[model samples]
Target: MAAGTYQNWRDVADLAMDAIAKDPDAWGDAGAGKNCRSRLIYLYNRRTGQLVRTQIVIQLSAHQSGKSNRIITAYPRGHQC
Candidate 1:
């Protein structure tokens, strides 16, 4: 049976966690500021059922007031700017 349209949330959460644990610098090195954003990329391959170690590019945002940031959006780097 089919469910809602947001089933991939789990996958994304997993990826985000993995990225954070694997490469904390990738997100923190993007820039410096209370309202800065960062990107984390990982290669995904279905044939081997594993990441190709390339880059997925997950864009996240930060705020000056709050201690936490939010995910603005994500995209395939080659497909977008």
Candidate 2:
């Protein structure tokens, strides 16, 4: 993996913080204190040359059934998805 790649678990945790700071509403019921896992998604827009980094969090539930998972989302400097 490349340096600063989001594929790793630690990077995901670090990016989650940035996501929290970028958009708190996407956090849903899971606040920063809650146990969560995140994935980093990159986007490109016509208006800008740089790519936008987005963080998506999967809300951990105790009674989650198979395929029935809870997820929370957060984005940085762009429209909420």
Candidate 3:
């Protein structure tokens, strides 16, 4: 039931954890000061039951500030935007 809303959070967490474990210095150190956000995209095939999930990591610009930098702030579907 939980998977209906957010499947890629767990998947992406595992992937990110594994990535950090493999090379801690590479991923963490690179995006320290940078503003970043992660979301999920799901893809399914009609021929197979398996679902393909991916993380959409967006790099926000420094100029986007004052709550305007948030995902819902500029998203077309969001009411706050």
Candidate 4:
């Protein structure tokens, strides 16, 4: 949604999932009271027509028994990758 052109939340979710399936360009701890970790992926922004850096934050403890992780947020950065 930060890109200002996605059709809906579903579209953003799809992109986020794709990014998660690949190796992250960068990643690190998300600090206290936030998701357990964060990852940065370089992805093509359809609206901007450029490769943008997207951030995906995962909350590992949100799910039952740690069976899966929850995406706290996913958005395209204002700058290009």
Candidate 5:
């Protein structure tokens, strides 16, 4: 899960789910995980529906042994490299 105020967002969970449903825009080898998937998703605040935040969801990799892929983190897109 994302740290700071992102966790408190009303649609934080939804954003993560959406990311999994969408095709990753970019990816790379994340070492032990085999690969990393980066997707863009939007999170909205509960009180204000107009409040939208763009986040990048990095999934560790596809399932292996029936286990689902794990999300490394979600952070504001374009805010960092």
Candidate 6:
């Protein structure tokens, strides 16, 4: 996936982790599937230099034994929730 305004994959991961850590309740149904989850977070856009609503999606590995959860995608969704 394209990093877009993000510096790199690590940058996106760090922001997503921080958001989840700060407010666990922010995550909700992503509707991608049973194992997928999504969260809307306000994050700093390095290009815009503004705080924007970003969407972070993660897929749980519940169906895959011994696998870990992984982020599926992250992007700026503007002000929409």
Taken over the whole model, the C-alpha lDDT of each candidate is: 0.44, 0.40, 0.33, 0.47, 0.56, 0.48
Candidate 1's TM-score reads 0.38
Which model, 2 or 4, shows the larger TM-score?
Answer: 4
Best by lDDT: 5
Predict model 1's lDDT versus the native: 0.44
Off by over 4 Å in 2: 1-7, 25-27, 30-55, 58-81
**Location of the lowest summed lDDT over 10 successive residues in candidate 4:** 59-68
Preferred candidate (TM-score higher): 1 or 4: 4
Question: What does each candidate score in C-alpha RMSD?
Answer: 7.2, 10.2, 10.7, 5.6, 5.0, 5.7
Instruction: Give candidate 4's error at residue 18 in angstroms.
Output: 2.2
The residue-by-residue lDDT of candidate 4 on 1-81, one tens digit each, is 435443466775665555554644444445443333334544456676776545543322233353336555555544322
Q: Per-residue lDDT of 44-69 in model 3, one digit per residue for the tens?
A: 43346567443333223232443323
Better of 2 and 3 by TM-score: 2
Off by over 4 Å in 3: 1-34, 46-49, 70-81
The parts of candidate 1 lying over 4 Å away from their true place are 1-18, 27-53, 64-66, 78-81
Model 1 superposed RMSD (Cα): 7.2
TM-score of each: 0.38, 0.28, 0.25, 0.40, 0.50, 0.41
Candidate 1 — which pairs collide? 41-56, 41-57, 42-55, 42-56
Clash-forming residue pairs, model 4: none
Which portions of model 6 miss their true places by more than 4 Å? 26-38, 50-53, 59-81
The sequence of per-residue lDDT tens digits that candidate 1 reaches over residues 5-34 is 232645655665456445544444234442
Residue 54 lDDT, candidate 3, scale 0-100: 38
The residue pairs that clash in candidate 3, if any, are none
